[model samples]
Target: MAFVGMDPERIRKVAEQLRQSSHQLTMVNETVQRLINQATQAWEGQDTLDFSDAWTGQHKLTLQQCSEQLEQMSTDAIEQIAQQEKTSGITPGGPGSALKPGDVIPGTTIPMDGLTPDKLNAMSPEDREKTLEAMTPAQRAAYLASLTPEQAAGLLNGMSPEQSAGVLAMMTPAARVAALSAMPTEDRRKALEEMPEAMRDEVYGAMDREVLAQTIGHDVTLAKTESTLSVEAEAVGFKIEAMGQGEMVVNADGSSTVKLHGEFGGGRTFGSDEKGASVTAGLEAEREYQFASPEDAEKFIADLKHAATSVSIDNPNPIDDVWKVLDSGHHVDRFGGYLQAEGHAELGEFGEIAGGGRIDVLATPSEDKLEASLKLHYDASANAGDFAKFSSGGEVEVKGELEHGQLSKIELKASTNGAFGAELEGKSSSGALLTTTHEVVQGSNIGQGGEVKMTLSADNPGFSQVKEALQNGDVGKATELAYKYSDVSYRQTVNTVLADDEHSVKLGAFGVDVAKAGYHFESKAEVSTLIMEKPAGSTHYYDISGGSR
Candidate 1:
């Protein structure tokens, strides 16, 4: 029984050792299987094998044991396989190891020794250009000689004209001519022309002038054709006027001699001593004059007028007695009755005329009187529509008070507005008859009388239109209409309208039949205010009657 029990214990211990050994074998198998699986996956491009796994004790064996086993496997199995593959006559270092016929080795610099044609042919265009650029003249010449004629020509064509010419000039004459002859005609001519002038002259001298002319003609034709391809350019047009006072003379040397006599509006006038002083190469065309002030200009004009008058009076034979009267100041009263006419005032110096008061007539005599009368009418018709027409005929006596030597309390009466067909008659302060026709239209008769009187305020529309037109853009139209409707009170109303649109308008007054002809008045005004607004956008209305009577 003891022996039996001992045998059972031995069997149990053996069983336990077998179990422990089996457990260790199972762990090793599991690890090996995982490593094999990972390696297989990596070989198939699916998963990576973790070499760190063996060193980190993730496997059954210790790190030292795993490393020793791996090293042994590499030395035995891997090396044996590699040797077997090599022994089969495979090339050393694997595919792409040996250099091909045209392959360049990495990091290899080109040789700078004697450049052979074969070596140059192997270089890239850029490399060749760089090499050529770096070469000395003698070296470049030697290299160029080695190239084929076609290759040399191509290279020369690529070079700048000046550089190519320099290189060509160094060549023998025969060689240069032969090379040029091989090029296109245009290219040949360009190369020949780029040569030194003496060389070019020698070459051209060999050719006939007719041939040279033909070549030039061809070039000219080509230039014209190319020029035609360009678009037409725009031209600017301007009007120029000669504004200086002087005589212009043309000189022999295609220059101009401007002999300035006196300073005119634009340029300095040559003095009397400079009569023969000719200005060679004077201002190109017109001379411009500059005036320091309006007063200076006026004085110049006055001097000119006095000079002209003096010359006329000093003539050996005078034309009329008027000149004689003007020459002698006191003779003026003999031509007309007392110069102190009620409605008339002598302008400037009237001492020459007997019984006359000197009053500077800055304003037009006819216009001033007409405007004054019209203002009275416009004031009386303040309630009328925008469009109203007034006419008058027959004799009308004007009665007015003179305040500060100006007309006031003016009165007018006559058949007007197409009602009475008769000539309009008015009396001057001297009781002279001044006649005007009356034209009638549809409108309320605002007033009619031989002696109408009223006080006119400065705020009145009659004054406002004139003032506004003068101060604004309708200046021109205002001036024109003011003269036209010299007798109308709101004559400058058109100017007011014009001033709103056009900025510049010049005003000028013209005398009518009621006063002496050729009388003029002027003022600065804006163009906009001078236009009148009708039912349409706007219209220019001008009174035909001179703003006189």
Candidate 2:
């Protein structure tokens, strides 16, 4: 008769052989890797490169795949033997006792639906796992999805680490993050410790940036002990307020000289006092975050890519928040800081411009405060096509604060002045110039009685007008047509709190008004708390009104 099932003993023997072969493959791979590592130190030339590439890009991968295949085969064989035993009733007095090396069992099948939480809980740990392993991924996922949170918590609490991992492996990434997030803090940490490194990284990547920030407070080991000092200064002896791009220098020897430059895009400038000359080179700027390890850096980058921010500020989230998200439920023994500066300058047709920016980031673990600041400045003058001369100068300053990895405050100051002049067809001559300044301060709290405010004003001809001006070579005409489209806004907020001995109350008032083109918007808010002395508690009240044009 044809064999319907292999002998369990024979299957076990074959599995042992597969396992041995896999072990041998691993040994060979290790030896080969050692040889490659040694050769890498002394190797040179195309032949060496070719050998290394073949070994790493093809041969090494092939060997690893083979080894994994062997191991999987061995595991499958053992599992198959167990399943057959269970199906055939292999005990001495059971139905399959009389069967030989080649035998067949009639109508043997395990019902997937027979596995329930009750059955799972009643079975021995080994049998429970075996039943779980028998289920397909779809079956496992469906079964898991059907369980209530309480049920899931109970089930997971009862499972061994391996079983728990297997259950989690069946979940989608989002579901997995949710599951972990729902777990009790200590249990979650223990579970993470029990998980495989690859699985841990996957969990980290899937977590919310803000949530991850709190979790990451544990694992990191270093913090910044000090900050670097930075200084910058600039001076102008004679500057034409409206020229936007011209600068005249009166030397100490009673001689004066004027320099004009114009350029487009981004660049940097270098000068030599001895040579009395300078050069401007076009370049692009780059930003980077420094981390203690490559793995941490990778996680930080991944979280940043997936993170979302509210429309409250122009600068990025504080560095501490980024660090916390990257940390992901790890203790940070100490904090560290990162400082970077980059500058560039380019010479345009009419004027010379140089600009650069700086970033300072520090995390104070002791005070639970994080600070970050940035500064940028630029000046340039260039011919706008054939008909216009364009010149502009601007500077930006921003400071951000985070308390315990949460944004608590921010401030921004910026100013710009520029002029656009055009002589269309060398006959229709027109020119326009504008200057702007903006300041904003936003915070969760401005101390006990602190105030917050912002002032903004701008006279932009709008982009469409600017484009038409550039195309028609009549900037002055464009301003005349669209300069009426202007914007001005002001906001002030005051917060005051009163507290003594046994009772406390707070009062707040905020107002803002904005006007642009012919439209206007205004809003106001006021709040007060009822005063209560010693025995009674204080009560607060508030009212707000939105203004209409």
Highest lDDT, which number?
2
The top-ranked prediction according to TM-score is 2
Candidate 1, residues 1-549: lDDT per residue as tens digits?
112212222332343344334435544655776687666664743233455445345654553355444433423432233234345432222222121223222233433343555565466645555666665443443344334545555555645555556655654332354455444545655565466644543334333333332222221110000000111111121111122233222211122222222111111212221121111111122221222333443344455446445544356443454344334321111010111111111223211111112111112232233122211111111111233322332222233333445543333332121111111122232222444322222222222222211222232234455457877888886565334322221112111111111111111123222211111111111111111111001111222112111
Tell me how far candidate 2 lies from the true structure as C-alpha RMSD in angstroms. 26.3
lDDT of 1 at 229: 11
TM-score of each: 0.18, 0.30
lDDT of 2 by residue, 1-549 (tens): 122376655655576678668767866987899888888888789988999889999999999899879867876775565556566655322344333222222222444444456655576656656655665543454445444444555455656666766666655443466777666544655565556544565565445543443333222111111111111111121111110122222211122222222221222223321111222222112122334343554454456445534223764665655545544533332233333333444554453455666565656566597767686767565666765556565667677677777655544555454544442221121222321212221111111111121211122224355457758999787554333232111112222112111111111122211110111111212121111111001011111111100
Which run of 10 residues does model 1 get worst, by summed lDDT? 221-230
Which parts of model 1 are misplaced by more than 4 Å? 1-130, 146-148, 202-549
> TM-score of the candidate numbered 2?
0.30
